[model samples]
Target: METESVEYVKQTMEYSRKRAIRTKLVNFVINKIWKVPIFYSESRAEGISSVQSDTDFMFEADGIFTLSNEGQIGLKSDTSVVYVVMDTHEVHSGYTRIQIMEGDWNDLSEFASSGDGLRSLCKTFGNHNSKYLSNILVKQFWETRMKSVIPRQGLKNEISSHGPSTVIRYAADKDVVEVDTLICLRGEWPEVAKEWLERKRNFNWPTKELIEEIKAIGCNLVPIGHRLSHGKELELEWRISFSKAECLLIWSLNGTQTACIECMRLFFQVFISPKFPDLFSSYFIKTAMFWLIEETDSTFWQPLNILACLDRLLSKLITCVEEKCIQNFFIPKNNMLDAKAVESKELLDVLRIELTRHDVTGEEKWRMLIKEKLLQMDKNDIYYYHILINSLSVSRHFIYNSIRSSNIKDSKDMLMQGIQELKCCNDKDMFSDVCKQLQHELEAILSIVTFCESQSDSGTDRILSPNDTKWVEETLNKYTELSHSTGKLLLCTFYFYIERYQEALAITEDVQTRYTSQVVHYTFWNRSKTPRDDHYPQITPRPTLNETLKNYIALDVVLLPCLSRLFRATIQEKLYSRDALFIHPLFYAFFVRFHCFYRMQNAAECEAVLNKMQTFVAENMDVLKTTQDFNILHLGDSCHQLLKKHTESGNYFKKTIKSLLQKGEF
Candidate 1:
């Protein structure tokens, strides 16, 4: 009974050894054919290593074997053969065995080729038993398996009809089969996504940090996908395989590895194509402008590179804009009115600011062209009116700042030409139209001063506000005798400048009370005309003359308080000493400028007028600094918040002036 038990135990040991060998063989075969690294299972048993061992031989055969072991296979006709052994029972002897198959020369080679094809045939047949095989392969493997491992229908038969049965079967349970089948689906992803994910996975594409950013930007995926293809495809296209939401998420979060023009184009393409086709061109153009503008501010990067890119983008954008407008059917999804105008204005503001740093000839030319375009925009088009006006003003200021150092006399000529264009429009019927022309002329004149200052110290002194002053004088003179109420109001401004205060007061009062029915629409004058004749007199004016102009001028008088403050500040700053020098004439010039601002009833215009005044102060800042006078400082301080601070002062002044201007109010 003990002897029987020992024999049974020995038999069990043999069986375990055989199982280990087969397992290794299966693993080796899979690695060789699939090129997938073999990871041993925890339950796998160790096997003897030898070329003829089932595992070793089969695995190597996948790499180098040329024939099947089950067939009459030979390397050469009637001479050579390869054999493999699967068992090892003789402990002292070489456990692996080999056998040679001999055949006719042609038949031998044909057998070898057929035998070689058997391995592929087995893979096609597939094994449901091996856990290793079941776990490693994915659904994607099926396509490759079908293409290479399996022969076409009727062309090759996997089952043998009459031969040594080579089909080795190990019992596979239902659970094992199901596990193997399901394993093909797990840990599997699209090949395209896999490749992209592998490249950027660790580096972080569509990172969690970028979640909010991804959502805000729609259609950002196109560029990102195209970029992943290294721009082999147009970025505008979306791969149909990916859901739109997924694509968008990827796109918004993906950042370019570099920022060259090509990359920028691709980056721009992602969002532009999907979310904002209509706005794409304009935004790109504006972005280019911003880049160039920033480059102008500092030579932080290569300006030439930026400029070249800008030119390309702007050209493309211009074409797109013209095309969209022409098509008419291309309504922007954003419903933004005049997108170009908004972009141009914003970009131009930044550009104008940045231009203070560069002195390049090319930069100047570019700036000039941009300014010219702004000036050319229609005054009636409110979409661009204010922005264009601001741009023009800034450009004019920039030009004046550069004019002094300019070697070219043509600069001055060009500025004068702009003035001429504006003057040509001054004959229009509308008061606003005439005012616009005159204002443009004023801006042009201011540009001249800046231009002269930029040219040279010698030319700096030549910058005269006198030209604008002269124009103002002429405009006032021309309007003084005109029958129009606006013209008469303009004449009162002239009186204020020439220091004819009483006369100025008289004209204001006449229009205020006598013509309140007609001119009450002009709110300021009606308010100014309500008091005594000593300070405000009701002059003889009929139905045509209006109080609006007078009230406006009177309200303008509120600015005097600010002027008083500014003068006092100026004195404190020693802009002028009380007893040292004459100051009335200079103050008169300030008055005339203030009158123009007050008459317009435009806050922005008034601010612009104040800025010009500030410019004058800045021009003479050195002089003021030297004096350190209290009176000048006071004056400067007075002007600081003139319109805003002294709102009620105008009303009181209006009451006081009523008696002076009135024919009968006193």
Candidate 2:
């Protein structure tokens, strides 16, 4: 018996060790494959770490890895960059319709004298009205300015070039990794964008400084290229980009706003996109966020209002999704969503389904997305896997369905079976598999509940009664001990919408009690809290195995509404001050607290935040001390200057809060 027990323990140890190694390998491969530069990572736009692709070791033939300013991944000795996506600092979501500018300009004075300049040239090259320009001035631009020796490619390589835009395709990581480089200029900017340019006050985009210092002399060009759309007349259109200015705009976002934007993007990507297909691009979401910020004050963008802001954005998106409209930030005439509606009305239909609440005015979708339910009881596999498969089939069909005609009731019955299987399954391994597969069914269940209760969509709303809410709350809480963080996250979201803010905050804690639940969302938001916003929901986009880790689920933004109840007393007392450690988000929290102070017109607390921020950066931060660049110290000096500017201007929350405070209601 002793020997048998010892053997069992040895087997368990070996299994555990192998599992850890497998997990580590998956993490390493995924990060190394996709990670770009720390400052401007596309991985954040997509994913930080992923488990989507297989780690193919079949090609052990050519091994290499390397890194560069762009965070290139290849062999250490092999830093062969075939192309660079020139001026990547300017890259953003909305700038689409790539147009390649061509031809020569030996004489600028001829066109510089004309009032239209590049615009006149664009009309001459195209049939003179709608088309912009082609065969105009690209060769002269690249040839004269480039000092570096031009490369001559040797055999078996390809260059697909048009005007200035060239795609230099190259491979890394034993040629398993492929990348394309683009060369283009900022073009096609409208008058509204110029008006926006005049509004800039802070340390603008690095490109903005470049433009001001060198090109204030007013050199200009018309970039002409064909649109990416297929089967068109191929008219040359003048296109431009404002990516540089936009990057600076992104930098101005404080921690709260950034987090909120990311969360909203995640929501659009996860719930909205799957149902709507290619209709909701990241650009549409980002442009809406930017427009919303322009309409609000800094206090309105604070952590406490993150969800409220997202709610407003979503309400607006419902209009865009339904009416097939989303206006471009720089060009209001460019409705970004119009082109997305050509394929079918399925996306519009799917959105309506999800957004449809008894009280919510926006969404109304088809009941079921599957045309026919498959069942073959003679097969043992079908009998075992049918419930799981059918639930996801219905869930995904609505997402992938473009036909717009799938409203059969295949899932309603499968859902019942799934619940039954959960209750009956006793085999731990089989039960885990069912839970993993049935998570979709769970999400479908919760999205409906969330939609009904959130009251997020504007239109006279209906609230779930206490009994109904409690029932749903009890149902959500069932997974609290089941190692499913998503279920817990859903439960916390339920608590947040239902106004149980204390319980919502306690969901992240190891031990829970009424007294310990004092950690309100903004309490942690404005304080120098240890653990930060870690857990992003798993049900977002697609579920990968790695998201099961506890730290990956975030709940703070949803709970931020609790701040409205707590901020007045804290700002009034002029208490609670702290300095940030390196990367602890200490400075960010204090920045928020100071803004709260400013909003309340509490001058003393605002000054306290600035003094502490300055001193902390000067003294404690190792990175700042080593670099001696005060800007790197949590962007310290810039933030100080902003606060100082605000103080000097005496424009303290002039929008909503100040007006209310002056009226004695706040």
Candidate 3:
């Protein structure tokens, strides 16, 4: 009996809840949907009524109609919410009507019964679900209850501040409910969102006209105007109801800006004239003068305009840098003492001063400054080239440090951009210098790559490999045809060292003309010792034949001895060609000659080779005695050692002597 009574109470509560929900929904449809205004007086006077439950009031183009089971309103669901079609007096009043919609009664009923719907909705909306679902009942009411109000033009006021909102109490004496005014505001206003809403609702002036007016000012809009205008100074202060700090900076940009332009022209004239006096042609100088002025005052740094300017400027600058003074644009470390280094130092000082003065430290400014200087540099000037390299190196280090410390990924492109500039260095010696630095850098980056690649589920390796390939291709491609071959070769060496062999091979093969025998040997020796055994062996069989080796007797001697050892003991000795033996004898003799030429002592190993060579020569002595220029071929200690070792071992120069005898018969 008690359980039955409890069940009855539960059923009663559920029924009441449903009835209350239906009532609220229906009221919203009638009031808000029907364009009704529910007014409440803050004062209890004039025979006004007090509130009970939420009520409905309607304003229609036609007269209100009482329901007679006749009027056609689009209410499809069994829920109490309904749609009424009518024209509302708002924007360009056409045949527009409100569409009534069913409320979430059925969904709510299912949610209450099963609890699954509530959980799903909670997951969907997260923390917002409680607020959204609970207030679902009031949403339709507010939507239908809205009224379109007329905008009022308010008084204009000037205030000094960086805040975005400026309020003016225009026509304060009048009973006006709406006002519109163009408030010169800053971008940093705390109530910016609120100001945006106010403007949208006619509480504040719209921005479209203001933007157009600023555009018509015949001066560009910027965070701070140029020297002819405000010059980063606070020029005026005005007060208003919103916030008092809304300051508008004003100046006669024409007069002042023109004067500043002339100043820039003079500055560019005298500053670089002494150094690059003949560097810029008359035509180019004139173009540069105009460009300098335009750059000084044009809205080049505006948020919307900056990227486009950078892109266009880069296109122009890249050609100029490639052809003219690319070196002036860079400052590699080795050339810091050059005159262009002095210029770069001065440029850095200027940038620092600008930053200090304006309290602005923007990466774009730094990048643009570097690029601009690069574009202006004379490409043929050695000093300028060094300076450009040095500058890029400095920037690379700065970006790398920043990226490392912050764990930011955005600096990836900046670092890469600096590296790209690095690759453009056409001077082999200078490029080599930069490549060494990059090789060291890759060690650190490689470790990071390894760590990232170790993640079990990460697909980063696939992404990183292609990215690395692209980076390498972009960095090394320009120098493939130029004088920077030595550096490029070394760069390839390190790349291969890091297991990026395919790219290394591609670059190295193209630049083979630059390879000295010493370089070939060094490259091959490093390859032999690489951790990647499979790759090293693949190249092992490749002959280290460089033209530079023709004159390098020492390498021939070393290589010949090593190759001869392979032939001496093998049953398949005939498989080794004469060219193989030709390389060995030449290699050993050259080394022995080197040691003797330099007056160095024969080491114990040399003493051994000397004995072997002597025995070989003694057996073949008759051959040499019969051959022309035998006296010119002065047999050294290596030959002496070969004969002595063989004689002491009791071979007695047998086979060699027979061959020498046969040669003598000829």
Candidate 4:
């Protein structure tokens, strides 16, 4: 029975391992699109789907450098450089004070004074004394800046500051994923953690090579102080954040070791947290896991011994609570449990009782707890998957919107990397399929846009060569099995571009008849209210025709740079600022139908199609505006004028189409 229990735990851990792979692949794509360097927090990055873990992101601030000593200041002599020197003297363990060494202070100053240039970031003791920057002030500055910036980026959520990080709560109905972002300054490896490199470890968990890599990676100084610091120290001290190093170490851990840590975290969240809210935290559990992994033999972290490893971790936690000394993994002198000592008595007693039980009853109790935790994780898996898909979709949308002629190669390289990495995770077939579909679609769109740019630059006609038509046909056909309406509509656009009016008209009629509300025209402008139900309805849900249509069929027809010339003459300069508008797939279908009729000289059919489009726009105006980036109101007026002018003179319609075709505008 004990072996069976361990086997069950191993199965759960295997599930988590697969999830971790998927999470990393998705995050890799997301990170590539981010403009600044970012570090995803440990638990989420590691694919621990426990609800207790919040997704945290640390962004390194640009143009702000941190120096370990005055000697390095000479290395950065640029007048525009903003830098701070680390002052480690007389500070708490794992904490330092940063003295501003260069740059114009007035540039950052909101209140200008006669002596604004001489003003310090925080406070100065004397005229000759160095002005030390305050961690509190830095945090306040970032929080204020982020609050002002987040809304402009289209996130309407209220931003708040929590310690060193800014928190954004994305609330959908009752489900909320709180994302914490910390802005920090990168610096050389801290002198305080240098001893960790030389520390004796019997197992040598983090090899010398890994240690060297971490040392070379350096560290960050977050705007946070020690919890036990006094008033002045609290304001002045900056915490030396080993988040990057910690993430690297966590990433290097074996699957069982990672699972063991996750189990310990689950134990803390379920059994300990509710009763003793502030007694300890997941970080304490993580620190204990690091210490245990270093002390124990590497083979002890095998799948069969996962429960035992978890037990050992719980024992270590109890020891920490009892002694009130949980040391920081990198800087052992910094006792993580120091501030929580006052609240540890009851928690210590409870943990000691829990750990001392080694009998069958205790074993059975743990089994029950593990089972319950696994069940909870299973339930939350859908929600986590929803978040992952949404994140991937949003990242793709951002990448597509940001892509220009200059960055096309870089964007393509990034997407290709995502595709290759996603393909390597063979165990996650469904996830890989969905992710690959998205990647291929984006890659296709990018390739077509690039091709269009090249053709436009060469002053070629819009007509496709035999090879170009074959490639376009093959690409559109790939989507046929998955997204019928989207593929047909894009194919229709291709035919129209090549002046195949009969084929294009037939496709438009078919799409118009088959199009329904079920087709998902995804845009970042409006998020689906029921993301879980719409995208991830089942665990390992197979990609059905309808599911693919809902998730993968973005109707991203507007992204074709070749098609942009067709609408460029109609759209205003203000609308052109967005480069391309995401039109409603249905509206685009009818719009294509109107074009086909206009080209065929069927004025009655063109007028009928225009009326249908007008009705569609009128009925779904609010929805279209919310879900698409296009100016439907302006488009409607343009269509109305075109049709009215066509009725006034047949020569005007014929001449307009002729001029547009001759100029390769369509």
Best by TM-score: 4
lDDT of 4 by residue, 1-666 (tens): 456556555655565555555455444544554333555665766555554766777767655677888788778765554666888888888889888765434243221221343143466633567788766666666676554333222123446778888887542212335678877778888778889989998998899999999999888988888887878778888889887688678767877787677666766676667866766778787888899999999988886776677777777776777787989999999887776665455666776565455322445555666676554443323334444444445445545444422344554565455446545643443365556656556555545545555666767655567876677667766755555465567667767867888988888787776664434444442243433344334546455433555443444444433345434355434334544455556777777787778778887887777677666655653443223323544554555566665442333334444554465423
TM-score of 3: 0.17
RMSD vs true structure, all candidates = 39.6, 29.0, 35.6, 9.5
Better structure of 3 and 4 per TM-score = 4
What RMSD value applies to candidate 2? 29.0
lDDT tens digits by residue: candidate 1, 96-192: 1111222222222112343332222122111332111111121223323423321111111222211101211111111000001100111112222
lDDT of 2 by residue, 347-414 (tens): 66677557544115422211110000011112222222222322222222212111111121332333
Task: State in Å the error of residue 25, model 3.
Answer: 57
User: Which residue pairs collide, candidate 4?
Assistant: none
Clash counts per candidate, in order, are 79, 28, 56, 0
What tens digits encode model 3's per-residue C-alpha lDDT throughout 167-278? 2221211121121112121111212122322333221122355423432321110111111222112111111111111100111122222222222223234433344443
Q: In terms of lDDT, which candidate is stronger, 3 or 4?
A: 4
lDDT of each: 0.30, 0.35, 0.28, 0.62
In model 4, state the lDDT of residue 376: 48
Best by lDDT: 4
lDDT of 4 at 265: 72
